[model samples]
Target chain A: MPVAKILRLPLRLAVHACSGLVEPLRALARHRSLFLLLLRRDLADRTSGTVLGFSWLLVQPALQMLAFWFLLELVLQVRFPGRIGFLDYFLVGMLPWLLISEAVMRSTAVLNDLSSLYSRMAFPIVLLPLLPLVMAGAIFGMVYIVLVGLLAGPLAALYAPLIIAALLLWLLPLAYLLSVVGLFVRDFRQFLPFVLTMFMYLTPFLYMPQMLPEAMQPFMVLNPLADILAVVHHLILGLPVTAGNWIRPWLLWLVLLGPAWVIFYRAQPHMREAL
Target chain B: MSVIALRGVGKTYVHYEHVLDRLREVVTGRRCHREHVALHPLDLAVEAGEVVGVVGLNGAGKSTLLKLLANTLQPSMGRLEVRGRVSALLELGAGFHPEMSGRDNVYLSGAVMGLTREQVDALYDSIVDFAGIADFMGEPVKNYSSGMFVRLAFSVATCVTPDVLIVDEALSVGDGIFARKSFDRIMQFKQAGKTIFFCSHSLYQVEALCDRAVWIHEGRVREDGPASVVVAAYNGFLGTPGGAGAIVPADAGAGAAAVTHADPVAADGAVQPAPGAITARLLKVEVEVDGVVGRRLQLTTHRSNLAVRIRFVSDAASPVPTVAVALTGTDGRMITSAGSLNDQRQLLRDTNGVTEVTLSFPRLALLKGRYAVNIYLLCERGIHCYEEAAQIAEIEVSQEGLEQGVVSLPHEWAGSVES
Candidate 1:
């Protein structure tokens, strides 16, 4: 009976616990050149001879900030007077969301793009997904610098550094996970774009959770990106940092990731066969 | 010690000769197809450090023996044991990625051969030098020509230094200089005392490299012996006499030979031989694999051991003629064929006498396990046969799993690949 009980428990809890300790150590020990190779290949395919390779990373969130400013200020005439003006407040919110989306999109084709690599030889599937995930964060880091340096007012200096750093730390594991899931399911390529669309509207990306439809508020606050995005807004805009934001997403992340990691554990055998 | 052992190996494949048979199975309540047995039951063994060459007509189970050893296919019956690590090149360079560079492919190739990352890393520099790809290790393999790809793959494969190496006809390791290098490497491996098992149609190569050989006809082994014996048998069948013209060897001691043996009187009122030397010889011998007579030869395998059987009819008339027979491949390569007519010095006395000789093997030694034996009859001047059979006897080898070599040559060779 005890054995049965243990069997009934999710395997994700064990796999994630091990992965948490092992992953960071492994990443640090890897050759720098391999990581550089992965990053370079991805960048070359995406930006070959384009007008702006690095700028594309910066411009997306900046464009969102511009859209929000016009929509809230001119169309609806809404107001949230604070240490920073409306446009600056929006940029702070948009940056982290942009990073999260980029991470998800990069992972969508993690397996499909590597199908040729798979048939040709045996590959360490565990390490490969990390490439796209790390590159996502790297692109985010590049964009984050220009904003904080060129545009962040003196108040922006105080909390922006600490808040964005914390957000990125949480994202590494999430991005790695999504990459693997996208690889296993055939529907992910088509279904994910729609899921991303839904996840965005459900989170407080456009408006505060208080202003959201009441019944949806709990799910909205529990969104993994929501609490982190709120922390970023609070740090840059000087909103009350004690709102019911931080604890909920952190708890939800821990719960969801435990089960997700188990699914990844089960997927390795099938992945090798298909690859 | 036996390096390879087998017990009761067999294979049966049901084929639907007509398209309708396949379609009916999918839709009908019952399946309708005829079962075709490719290989029959066989039991055999190979000692460690022995080089064995397999010879048979096409479909005589040559490749099947190699495939079974490599664990590529599960035997229908019996068990096989291959001691130590066996590296198989059933298909040369099967897993090279076009987009990955040659250096990257070394790791990839090693993994397919069951080498780990760290192991390949330790041997990386050596593998690169062996492939002679120092100048092109960084470029994507797709850009490399077929010759370059083979060089890189062969380099990585040979560098691993496996305990047992199983090679198909992939011996044309590369072009020109690379081919020469590859040939030297194979010979080097042979000198190292590593066990080498190979199958090739080049009799000269097989004779040169293999000490032992096996001949397979219609999926069964006909003979296993020294390369010399097998090669001669294969050649005999190839140049066999054809058409309806018959060879009737002469009798040398029609009256005098018989008188000395105590049965001095002839049965057909012919004179008996006196005491002393009574020299008689076989004028010619002919054999066919499957077709009856005067039909076109349709051979399936090209192994050196298994071919058509020949029958001899001796006579003591004429000039006491000598007789011979042989088997050969469609590409001028010999399987299992041999006889003595012109090579022998003795001549027959009675030219009107007729006798019959039949050639046969234990089991068909082919993988697809099929071949047509060619029957040839030759005298001092011309050829002969009954009605001229295309393929002699349609034989099939039962593969229950005990079969060891593809052609099951009687003899075996010993050597190692360059480490």
Candidate 2:
């Protein structure tokens, strides 16, 4: 009986995790075309009035990366002390960082930004948080795959998609959590960009984790984003990585999945009234 | 089977001092907000193929109830069941995106309504033809005029008919031609045996379109019955004198002799407030026909004299109050009304501030129908009413021959038309 009871614990946790993941995916499937239509609308709204319309989706990100490369390589003369080229290393780390920051930043305001689409009507509101994820995934997925194909070979470029899929799954809980928090606590949205900027400086995107002072190196393990980038470099570049790097972020993700979903579910009734 | 059922369904809106208090209350499990009951718990059942109209004053929970049925709002407590594909035309542009082109929006709105791409393709041309904006379908909706915008939205919403349609006063959607078109579409839905829940202030339209009505007052069902009866009761309530803070005392008729110098007292004794300072109210209203003094009378068409004797009291300071008498059908339609002011007559009160006037229609020409008498005490101009006694008497007229409508207009066979 005790052995059976112990076996049921992992079974329960597995079911809990699957439910948290499956419920949203089911809702998305029911509203699959609507999700796509709204995703297109969201993508268009960002570049609607500009003279350079849909092309800006690609040009804007490319221009931003160019500026970062100019400042870090040409002006600051920062070099990576490794066999891997500095530009390849920076591109591999920076593109995924861009995808994460853009999706996370937009998740904070996604509900409020598209509230009119669902507020006064009967609509599936669960699809709203997924919009920013799919949008950022599409744009950065193409850019990352193309760049990786150029630097590391065609076979290695295929890993870019797997990398993006993992990041989206990891971001699922955070997106739902931030969407609810962002609407209820408006001040969180106001200073969120600053927080994202601070997060970027802490993550090893601009500088490798080794370059940080010896004392601060131990603390890098505390940032899940650091764990995420470490795994990505291991998978793509064959860099050395520990099992903790693999286990830490997924462990945190598992911890947050159920709570984030529960909070969002409880807050559904208040969403319309909050606006 | 009941298509819509609500058991103890209610909504109470909780207002927090700050938005954060909502969070605090949720986190702490303590009361931190005040509540306003938008709707009280009540049970209602709407059967299939019944057209029910909702009538109420502003902010009387009509919209809340409709939202509950439309699934836009969750009730605070109770079970609400609406069975069928319920389509709500609450706001025409609810799911419309301003940046999307009209063509794209049609598909988008179809998706929002749970239609597939194939379904939207089938309805696309019809929607475009109905909106009459085919040339501009490629333009972004933000560039469309308000009329064009609403017309397109209306076309999209009604293109596919649902089993039950809930309309919140969107009948008059655009310009005159388009309004007629939209009204025709709703009429078609009604003719197709679709159950409809309509809320509107247009009483005439409600009486014409709905078979039953529900009157919501202060978050409760005040009256619910046949459309004409509920509308008549609501009309009488609207015409009640004290609704607008008139100065007539509640017992004005009981103590008429002792009530003297009953003027609205001015702030300063030296200055007399000239306008509406005098208090006026009805003292007695008597309906007499064929030498019988009673509330309900039987009369012969064009042979009975309908006489109404009105006695009222007015202070000496202001103008004498006008007296008006109206005969109406039992459905609250005014057949005819006669006022002393319209005839340019001046009235005088006795020394005790009481005035009596009698209006007699000798040989009344009213045809065979049940009619009601309503008396009003009006201002000198006959515009503002000081007091009213609605449905004071009932007159049932019998005729020798068949004559339709409420009145018998004077006629004599037209003196042999060329045949």
Could you list the CA RMSD of all candidates, in the order they appear? 18.4, 15.2
Every candidate's lDDT: 0.58, 0.82
Candidate 2 residues lying further than 4 Å off, grouped into runs, are A1-14, B27-29, B241-419
Instruction: Identify the runs in model 1 with alpha carbons over 4 angstroms from their true place.
Output: A2-16, A19-36, A44-83, A153-180, A210-216, A242-244, B1-142, B153-169, B186-334, B337-419
Per-residue alpha-carbon lDDT of candidate 1 for residues A1-275, written as tens digits (9 for 90 to 100): 98977885656465675575366437435533444444555665566556987577567666766787788878987655445555565566666777777777876677667555443333445555666656766766666656765566655665655655566556555655676667655566678788788877766646665667678766754566767777776666556554567786666556555555555555554554333
- Tell me the lDDT of model 2 at A169: 88
Binned by DockQ into CAPRI classes (incorrect, acceptable, medium, high), candidate 1 is incorrect
C-alpha RMSD between model 1 and the true structure: 18.4
Q: Is the docking of candidate 2 incorrect, acceptable, medium or high quality?
A: medium
